[model samples]
Target: MQTPPSRAPNADQIDLRQVFGTLRRYAPWLLLTPALAAGGAYLLSRQQPPVYEASASVIAVDNDAQNSLINNTLVTAPPLPQGAVEQVMHSRSVLNSVVGRLQKTDLDPALVRGIARDLTEELADNAFTRFKVRARLDPQQRGVYELRARAETPQAAQRLAEAGVESLIAWDNNRAKQGVIRSRQSLQEQLADLTARIAATPPSSLERQSLIAARGQVLQNLSQMAVLETAASGTLVLVAEPVAPRAPVSPRPLRNAALAGLLALFLSAAGALLSDSLRRRVNGPEDLLPLGLPLLGQLPLLRRKNLGQGFVAASHSGPLYESVGFLRINVQSLLQEGKHRRLVVSSAYPGEGKSSVTAALAESLGASGLRVLVVDADLRRPTQLKVWSPDRLATHPLPGTDPALPPATTVSEMFLRPEAAHATRVSPHVDLLPAGTPARGGLPGILNQATFRALLDRWAQGYDYVLIDSPPMLSLPDTLAVAPSTDGVLLVVEGAKTRLADVERTLENARVANVRVLGIVVNKLARVGSAYYSYGYGSEQASPPANPNLRATRV
Candidate 1:
């Protein structure tokens, strides 16, 4: 026999279909997170107090008289850089003056008191830390500055902005008058020294006469310096006055809510991806492709109420029945050319519905006019009796068996006494040998390799196909022990509940035991879109008649 080609490993790669499946499962949580975040942001924004802003504009230029004095080399002073205008406006002196003006006002007394206290404390710690009054220069027009102030009310904001402008102007004027004031002080000192020297000298000396002449020149220079000082005006000129604003600049609820919603959405998507990676499980058929096992069929998840009945293929007639029919066809095709007759059905763990799948497959095969036999091999926990109701079994005993003698009822009793064993008909063409009574303590001691294989050969001769329902392979050694005797094993896995690691471990155990795995049957899948099995026929309609031309082939 030729082996199937090996597929490349895709454990490290991400599948988009799997990602979409994960997102669909957690759709409600993803939608709820962003809404809650946006609502929280909106409420927080509304709680904040409103703040009003008012601005005043000014222009900086050189004082005409002072510029002339420096040009003529009569006074030496460094020119103020354009960039320093902002620094000057925010200086401690200017802010202190603004604070003083606020104290004298009667408008918004509570606001005035708060501003006065905060500014005083902030300035003492660091001059640059004070931010009540802000200064910014116009980028397009050089030497043009805008002074802004923020307060609790419109009237207080306007008052603070106007005070800041006046204080800056006064400071600039004082800086310009420094040169003239210094020159005047020097002339007055010279005049006073000449007078003292004349008083101290003899009444008629040439030195006194020269000193008197110098004193008159010094006094005349002092008078001219005073006139120059009076002519000097400040460089700063007011361009726009502050006015009360109509709207507040802060507490924008809509914009804040929008920003919060976007941030929350990104975080939720990333979290979903990370969580799916950590807790990876089977979501669809694509998740099983990495195991390198040929897929047999996919069965839709049945309602909880139908699970207790257990035989979905016989009792239900919608998607489950159609899907079982497809599974039966695939199994017959695989075993048609080989000498394989008996097969063991099992899963990685218990409660995966492996027993139910066995009962349904047997019923479907029997419906095709082939005699099928189902043996419940799981002695510890038998479920076939529950699946096929006890009342449905035929009362007639097997042919050629003595009616007066007692027949072996359970699989364990059959293994002990093969000659006395007998089978009971469950359906028209199907027979069931249930695991009569569950073994106490552990597995029955009669399950020997040679005895179990001999009994299977005897039971399989009367039927075309034999299905043995074994226990979970990973949980106990009974499945693996009985698996080597069967032709092959059928692996059953539940959708969205079985983990990938568990499936891999189960496959490894089967390989080590030298068991042939037929294929994987993904069961209990959620019917969503084309990912799961769905038939167009409605459940209310009668079952479609089977085609008479189709013939059952045997190996």
Candidate 2:
């Protein structure tokens, strides 16, 4: 048969099962936040306006050809320059006209539902100009300028693009006409003056020849300017007309929802795991492994209020009874070789089920026909009397029942004393020594007395086993004071409630006091699964007393 695991778990070792179990335990919280986040993202997406885009292109005049035809004069300038095209397209006056035209169109209510009214007012005043329109030269075709516009609806975007294209053409034509007309008027005046000056000079004179040549050159220049002025009103021509887009470019609900949900899930799980790690509480056997003690047994969570009462009185014959029996066997196996029959049951704090476990253990041992004496050593807050009623003790005739019972050693004589008058036999083979009313001397005074150790020795000589119920180690020094004389200490840890640091501190205290720790009893396991309820160490068959002979040896 394989022995129980002797060494504690490595504190640094990672266990995948532990991770799964933690996730299972906190599944509700993990699921809730991510769902909420995803829902919120989807709703926010729905509230946003959809954006549509449309593009238009225009042909720009070649600067080199236009300038050469105009004789490169400052007055006869090129009709269009690439650098100035973008600036003129987005200029304040040009954009204002486009915005005014857009505001007049009947925009669809469903497309721009939330902000349509505000958008109309802002566009009329040219206030919503950010990224609404852009102008740039086409990369594939030189001298071709492209106009792009975005709006709440496809029709609105198309209209904005067309308006920008038309506005730039109108501005370019008006500017070109003014410059050409002014240059032509100035040249006509100069040509008339040269004609008058040549008429006044004689045909044979040197000045007369110079005047005629200048006049001829002026007329030739006038002819060229007149031809250039009538060529075209504007340098730019339409290449591609703006069309309504097929789809909106933004407000992707599915993608946003999925990303938000994943982010929320990661944050929630991380926070829960971090909090659990920092607390480091004993949740089950997995946590208790760090204590380096044999897991004698794991007790199920008991619902009965009087679990501290005798197991026989409670009529509990389920796994709880079997588990208690299991603990008794392992404890016997450990102590059978030594003369130390005393066992101290305690925990790190009050309400850890230490008192109830002590009572049940004694009752389980007695059921196997062993003479067991249970002492309530927690004088500060005694509970054994409430557990095993003192009234039950009165019903049993201690010495009258046993034929070989020592006459001088009555139950009352052995337990009833000036300090403890309430001790009595509550059941057959089992006795109770209640911690009576608080004495004039406190718990420290009572446990520290020489009589306490002497009394323990006398009881050991008479009873097969002596189980003492003591106060929590951290709560009071009573258990520590009584630990040195006991055979061994059994620490009781409540699952998911008792902190690991408290258990370690209690163990260190026992160590300093020279008390041998037998093992650990994990109580209040919340799981109702078969793994927690079933016994794993030994045969399911309940064994009879290995030694039926009940005579106690004198020390």
Candidate 3:
């Protein structure tokens, strides 16, 4: 499993399939997070108050009508440009005036001011709304402007637009009236001085005539100014009146939901990619691609609630049973080509489900009428014997049996004396050799002895299949030393817990011993999709409930 010396690093390749497979494995979270985010946005959007929009059109009018008429409408400088008018329409001063006018309605003034305050705050906080309320120049006509406004109600929106035009007109009228009043006062003062000068000049002098002519012109201009003030209304003329809208224009749920969904999707995809990058453990078959090992089978995870009851094949239904059957089938095919009958079960580390897989596989084979001998070779921490012979003698002797410290009582006694060691028959076709106790020389000394090899050979010739449950390959050297003597090694990998690098190291160790790894068995798989959810999707036998109590029926 070690990387080939000639091959480049794994980073050099872009494995999109593996990336997508990781995403698929975590699809529920990837889909749920985005859905929740979008749902929250939708709920928030729906809580917002509705908005009504209205527009009013206005045109710039010449305030100096009399001067224009006397001069035959000569070209004059324009009062304000379209850009300046747009700014004025949305200016705080103009909006304040509009708010004041709206507050003076026959309706409750407090309610009007409250809505106006909220709108003002919204416009101040949101740049979009600020620009939306501004005036726009008409494309078809020059010196024409469209003032738009938004409010909580149709009447308020219409009144706000109308108030913008009124404010402009009022401001222009005040400016014109002040200018006329100033001109009239100056003219009257000049007229009084000229008349006094004429009276003081006596007779008819050139200075008196010139003064009189200036005074008469001033008097005429004052009369024209007075008439101009009375004739013209204001500098701005209302071209279009604002009308109440039939429908509100805000709180657009559809648009808001779509935008929220897109945002959620972007964030969710980013999180998924980040998680995939940080993942270190193997989760499924795709994770085994780089290891170059054939996946023999996948056993569903036996939850803690389902454990402590022994081998998984006891119920003989569901995915665990089906997986054991498949493993046996693959082993049978390999054996048809003269493969070894002694299969050693080992894993990368302890608690990787190797012991459970060995017990279940042996049980499945035995049920098929094949004689199977399960040996607990893991001297460091043996488990097979405990599962098969729960009531087997550990320290006490069985009644009616040879009490002279029976020679073939346990596997440890058999290692010291193969001629006396006997296999305990658990079922009709299944037998077990428990690793009752370690010898004084320990596991290495025991497995390396000539007696242990001779006993294994003798059992290989007798039993149809010899399954040895060895200690974790990475944790101990017992499995590697005994693997060469066995037919093949079945590496067990726990899903989502076994690191790929650790499995690779374990396989490398096996390869160094020149042992053949039959295949890998991914154990403790979670039921996610249809492929793993159904126990017998295509089988003729109906699938039974999981964890059914065993009735000890004959196979």
Candidate 4:
């Protein structure tokens, strides 16, 4: 048989089947992780106390507006620089005033969110406080500031906002009065000096007259300064009064839970994909398609209840029966055109159920009315006898070959003395040659001898087909040694357990040994959906009679 060209590994290629298979395999974790995260977030959110917010808006008036409020002649303080309203609101002086006003209020302490012995100390030391300020420019190009405060109760939040507005207004008023107060003090001192000078000099003296006239002008200016001081008010004007909010602004449990769930879902999916990529296990038949080998059969994972009965007996009914029947048909079709009756069955690793698969295939082939012989080639670990029932062993032993030769009881003895070797019928049309005990350290040399091939050739004449149950290819060289004497090697791969790299390495080893690989048998595949393993007919349904038209025709 001409082997197909080997496929080069593509690093950038993505197999969607493998990706979906991995997700299906870990569906429970992917679903549970996000749900757990969302539930945790909601519970934590519920534990947090609600925070109520109230905001008050203050606008900065221009110098023109301030002058209109007071006398035009009065000197008003300079207009506040742009974007300085927030800084001034949060300034130590303004905040201290705010804290003092809050303390003098008759509000209950229990209503406040975080109250300390000293309100000033609490305001200064606490990194996260109830008070906050934001400044912005109004449409008129005037500076507007929004004073915001948060507390446990709506009434407390409103009180704090109102106190902030009152404090800022007081600070601005004091600032506006400073210039007028200083002017009045300077005028008063000049008037007092003029009176003292007039008393010391003669009434008719020119110097005294000049001083008297100057003192009258100072008196007039002082009177105007007095008026300005009483009329002057701060440039800051309260635009919007704070109101107690109906609802709290924070501790949104539903929104927080939703966000947390979405974040966790993304992370869990990424973790699953990364883990699957790193594991590199065979997920399905698509994983083996790159090897350029025909997939002869796929057996679903056996249920735990049916496992104790073993695969051979389990193959009599259920999905396993139909699957094994199909496998037997494929094997017969492949072997019909060529003289490939003798085949070695093995896997990449132990515990992959290669021995069970060999027994199952033998039983299936025998059911088709063909004589099948199962040879236990693994001398180190023989399992064919155990796989079959004890009563089935030596039920119909072959007659003695030559009267002069002693009959061989085991395969090891047959290699030593070929004339004595004989097969015992284990089932109808099925025989087993179990691997018997041999001297330690003597089996390897015995397998390598020419008599081993001669024994297989002689066995082929009596049986229609010989299935050699060999050891794992990667673990021991015994299978590789026995493979060359057979027609071809049948590789068994356990789905989701065997690594793809290990299977590739096994194929590479077979190539090096110059053994022809017939095909792959995917075993223990996970039963995912109804499409693959579940048949519409139940086990209790009557099986249709075998069709005579269905025959293993040669291609």
Best by lDDT: 4
Query: For model 1, how does the per-residue alpha-carbon lDDT over 176-275 read when each residue is reduced to its tens digit?
Result: 7898998888888888889999999887999989888999999888877877787655657899999999998877888889888888877887798788
Model 3 stretches astray by more than 4 angstroms = 1-20, 58-82, 115-131, 134-146, 169-209, 226-240, 253-258, 280-555
Q: Extract clashing residue pairs from model 2.
A: none
lDDT per residue as tens, model 3, 1-555: 221111222767865655666678777877887778778878988899898888887777564557656543222234665466656655677667767776676546766777567658856865435224344445422466677777778887787777767876676566556656677788889888888988898566888888888888988987887775565344467888989999878788767877888887777777877765675777666778788777777777766544545554342555566667777887776666443388899999998888878877887787787888888888767777666544433332222234464556566777666555666666556677888775445544577566687777765655788899988989878787788887789999987778788888888888888988988888876642224335454243643332232323211
Candidate 4 achieves a global lDDT of 0.76
**Candidate 4 on 1-555: residue-level lDDT in tens?**
212212423659875666787788788998999899999999999999998999999887775644554447555556666656666665778777776777777678555324433345644675435667777876555778788988777887888889888988888888889988888898888888888988999989999889888988998998888888887777778999999999989899899999999999889989988987787887667677889888787777887778655556666667777666667877887788544388899999988888888888888888778889899888888888777754434533343345356667578877777667777666676788888763456675556667788767876775778999988999888888878887888889998778899999999999998988889888887653225346533252533332222221111
**What TM-score, to 2 decimals, does candidate 2 have?**
0.54
TM-score of model 3 relative to the true fold? Answer: 0.54
Error of 4 at 215 (Å): 6.4
Weakest lDDT window of 10 consecutive positions for candidate 4: 546-555
User: Residue pairs in steric clash, candidate 4?
Assistant: 408-420
Model 1 misplaced regions, further than 4 Å: 1-18, 60-91, 107-110, 120-143, 201-213, 216-224, 227-236, 281-463, 466-489, 492-499, 505-555
Off by over 4 Å in 2: 1-269, 283-291, 302-316, 338-340, 389-422, 436-445, 459-461, 526-555
Q: Rank the candidates by lDDT, best first.
A: 4, 1, 3, 2
